[model samples]
Target: MQVTIDKNSGYCFGVEFAIQMAEDELAHGGMLYCLGDIVHNRMEVERLNQKGLRVIDREQLELLHDCKVLIRAHGEPPETYALALRNNLELIDASCPVVLKLQNRVKHAFDLSQRQDGQIVIYGQPGHAEVAGLAGQTGNRALIVMTEADLDQVDFARPVTLFSQTTKSTAGFYKMKALMEARIAAAGGTLDSFDANDSICRQVSNREPQLAIFAAQHDVVLFVSGRKSSNGKALFSVVNAVNPRSYFIENEGELQDEWFAGAATVGICGATSTPLWLMRQVAEGVESMGELV
Candidate 1:
């Protein structure tokens, strides 16, 4: 059997930058606190944690004082910064530039909307760290639309400016935008009153077709990803749809020997938040499962 790792797999630019920052900070002799998992992958988090990266939440952040904290790539709401200021906690901001730009755009749009009765609409999972950060730009007034059920909460009659989380599916965002436009048009609303930005990151959007191709070329796919990764879920669906033999796993330990049955070729890949080293580990695990025929 042959085992290969997808060249396009592993951490994105934002995640790479964040992990680097954490490593650089950890290299220094001092206590370091990260607001959340440095990356969504559990193995990466554990690796960092082994080097003294303390994970803390908002509530815990408030109780701490005069500490140095690193914000993960997911970005944080404005309240996090404010609390850090009040608590005298120095921040190591590692928010992705794409996300930072989207946040600014959302905030600007929200500010402009406040002049009228307009509302800011975001296409993202509710309560997701990135989505929460984007919603915070609208002072928590941005309507989060994750499904058809949430779409009803948006006011089609009023002016709306739509934005999406950096990692959301491009097709999904397009559908959301089209649905909003249809709703407004059906209600006799003018198109000029509504605006939506294509905020989904191209790096992720481009990976969909590439991942589908990778999945199809293999007999079985081991897609490594953290359970908490939104991009992981989105990309995995693409692969699974293309190749039902695809399997998702967090680590090499999750690999079952039975999965390799009758498979002459196996592919190993992962989400943007996944580390390359973890993919290598998974490949090694597959190698140990049996002899290549």
Candidate 2:
């Protein structure tokens, strides 16, 4: 059996930066509190937790004071900063530059929308950390839509400005844009009154075509990612579509010997948030399975 790992797979720059920041802080021999899971991958989180990184939620953050808290790649809303100030907590912000820029754009657009009596709409997973951060930019007034049914909340008669979560699939964002355009027409509104921005990060969108090619090249593909990762789901969809033999797993332990039956070549790939070491471990597992098969 021939096993290979996709060179394009693994942590995007934003996630790599955040994890590095966490590790650098931990190296100083001090207790560090993280606002959430440093990354979507549970194995990576567990590894950091062993290094004295404590993951806390919003409620926990509210109750703590006079300590250092590390914000993950997913940026926090204005409210979080306000709360941190009130509690005298030192914030070690590691927010992704892309997310920060999106937040700024959303805030600016929201201000403009107010003058025209327009609504801010977000194409994102409802209640997601990054979505919450983006919604916070609009003062929690942005209508979050994932499916066609979620569009019911929008007022089609009014002017609408739409933005997508930075990590969302490119196809999904365009579909949402088309849906909004149709809704505007149905409400007797012109396209000029609606604005849709494809805010998905280039790092993610660019990977789809590359990953599709990678998936097709292998007889069997192992997609490693945390099930909770948004981009993991998005990218895996592309892989599964290209190669029906693809299997999504979080770690090496999830590998099945039966999956390699008669397979001459195997490929390993993962999401932007996936760690490289994890992919290497998966590759090793696949190689070991070759002997058994």
Q: Could you estimate the TM-score for every candidate?
A: 0.97, 0.99
Q: Superposing every Cα of model 1 onto the true structure, what RMSD results?
A: 1.3
Over 1-293, each residue of candidate 2 has an lDDT whose tens digit, in order, gives: 99999999999999999999999999998899999899999999999999999999999998998999998998999999999899999999999999999999999999999999999999999888999999999899999999999999999999999999998999999988998899999999899999889899999999999999999999999999999999999999999999999999999999988899888999999999999999999999888775544
**Model 2, residue 206: C-alpha shift (Å):** 0.3
TM-score of 1: 0.97
Top-TM-score candidate index: 2
Q: What tens digits encode model 1's per-residue C-alpha lDDT throughout 20-134?
A: 9988998986999998778888899999999989998777888999989999888988999999889999998999999998898999999999998999999998889999999
Candidate 2: residue 25 lDDT (0-100): 94
Q: Which residue pairs show collisions in model 2?
A: none
TM-score of 2: 0.99
lDDT of 2 at 3: 92
